[model samples]
Target: MRRTWLATAALALAAALLVAGCSGQPLSEREKGTGVGTLLGAGTGAIIGAAVGHPAAGAAIGGALGAGGGYVVGNSLQNRQAENQQTQGQLQQQQQEIENQRQQIEQMRQQQETE
Candidate 1:
């Protein structure tokens, strides 16, 4: 049983390395996002595959799915960031308007006091 477990662990490690090896190039923003997912998926797949006796196929499918998922997540995060910036800008504008109103109110109060 110990020997079997050791062999399984070794196989999973090798599969993980193989998946890592497959990814080698200049990563774009999308690719970078996908990379983390892919690595995690590959590791998951390796262990699952080893346990179920289909390590290579599982790893391959997992890597592909992970990359696709990661790209989507990255795109979503980027969109959300842009939306936040726009909201911040609008808030700033609103704040400036409020300041102007406060100043006008102060001026009116001063005039009434003098009268």
Candidate 2:
């Protein structure tokens, strides 16, 4: 029974790792975090469940919790990235305005000198 349980757990872990590594494109930060969390959670849960003679249940619970946590973290990171991009855009606009004002001032000074 113990050997069977161990084998099952090992198989589950391998499958999880394979899924995580199979994606061809680079995973977004959130996806990466979620994948990592899910795998870790599943493994940990399996170990605990095996201790209590319920490895499958433990893995399910752990995977759910880990995925939820990863989603939240990923969303937060994405929001931060968006905010940073907005700030940069605002700064660029401000710089352009400043340059335009400088140009106008220069034009006025040249006109005054000519008059």
Best by TM-score: 2
Local distance difference test, each candidate: 0.73, 0.78
Q: Model 1, poorest ten-residue lDDT window?
A: 1-10
In candidate 2, which residue ranges exceed 4 Å CA deviation?
1-25
| CA lDDT for candidate 1 | 0.73
Model 2 lDDT per residue over 45-66, tens place = 8788879988878877787787
Global lDDT for candidate 2?
Answer: 0.78
